[model samples]
Target: MIRSGNPALKESTFLDLGTGAVVSRNAGAMTLNGTVNRTGILLLLCVLTATYTWNTALTPTGELAPGALLYILGGAIGGFILAMVTIFKKTWAPVTAPLYALAEGLFLGAISAMYEVKFNGIVLQAVLLTFGTLFALLMAYRSGWIKATENFKLGVVAATGGIALIYLATIVLGFFNINIPYIHESGLIGIAFSLFVVVVAALNLVLDFDFIETGVEQNAPKYMEWYAAFGLMVTLVWLYIEFLRLLSKLQSRN
Candidate 1:
């Protein structure tokens, strides 16, 4: 059984796809290469939309361009709704995944611009660190240096759940103007918190790798390639955001 920390990817995501049923003449089983190609397409879509919002966030005076907040809020909410839809209807991933990527790009671009404006070169640093960590972990997982053992998966999942609960509580408490102490501060504790979150986010990718491989081994439907890719993208987005926050916290200290 495959278990991942990503909410978008459950243990049964690829298992209940009528594995024993006859496949249509036009449909092919999921493959690693196919998922990789679809992931590339989704990433391209994200970069295209991100460029638009990144440019839009810039202005003549280097201040936030008009309607930047609109893009951020629209992207965040729209992406979230689309993600939920795709999670429930896996078949719709071919269409919804790209849309989710685009929406996320808008949100990421605006947020990155805001960070960049305050701390020069921070966005670039965050981007490089994000992808660097991704490739490093991919290599580690591929080389068998970082196996997704059952215990490891369980630990990561538990930690991820705890992190989610903390974030949820923080959001709820915001209504009362209550902050979670040093967790959001720029001090050592805040940086440490962000670093821990980033590590957990990175570890989630190993589970994602295991899940996608399981999907291929199970001979899931071709559309599942897109679904699996979507799941991976979800983790990557979360990792990138945490990297941004961590970098910002560090920059604030200097």
Candidate 2:
């Protein structure tokens, strides 16, 4: 049975489902960095889109310009397509990963620009802190400092689901005047929530690692590499946004 804590599965490392080939545990295991490298081409596209959207603005003169809605739409559509591709691993990841990245880039850039106008400099700080957190999480994972256990997985998964529900509810509440307190600018509550989210996001990396390791061990198809990258990108995007929102909330209070 394919279970999370299968010892036999853990004993052997790195099986290519494409070829039914198995390699030593320490020999061919796919590392997170390696999977990222495989998807670098797609990531570059995302970066370009972000840069282009970041600079495209209405300026103080107020000429015709793409509004925040455009960025938000592009990001949403891209993310939807990305999820589709990830779920249908055979045909989507290879084709849509790059496009998804591009869309996200444009969205993040535009969002960052808007925030910059409102909060000034918080964007840069958020970016730096996001990367810092990513680096820290990766290092800790690699060093075996934070072991991924069944309980850890359940906690993060539950927290993530709760957060998603809250976000969706908040969005729906926008039309009714019932705002989600402590989410946007409720001071300490917002900060506490953000911190909890950050912790959950960081813990997601552990799940990501487990998936990668499991895939490699199970001999999942080669195309899964792109799918795996897509998953990582999704988590990273989430982490970045939470970081940005938390920073914005904190800055707004100051």
Best by lDDT: 1
Best by TM-score: 1
Give lDDT tens digits, candidate 1, residues 1-254: 56799998887787444564524425688899999999999899999998899899978677788788888899999999999999998889999999999999999888878888888898898889988998999999999999999999999999999999999999999999999999999999999999999999999999999988877877778888899999999999999999999998998998
Note each model's CA RMSD in angstroms. 1.7, 5.1
lDDT of 2 by residue, 115-229 (tens): 7777778878888887787778778887999777777766777787788888899889998999887656748988889988877876786777676767765545455566667
Model 1 TM-score on a 0 to 1 scale: 0.96
Candidate 1 — which pairs collide?
none
Error of 2 at 81 (Å): 3.2
lDDT of each: 0.90, 0.68
TM-score of each: 0.96, 0.82
Q: List candidate 2 stretches off by more than 4 Å.
A: 1-34, 58-66
Superposition error at 52 for model 2 (Å):
0.4
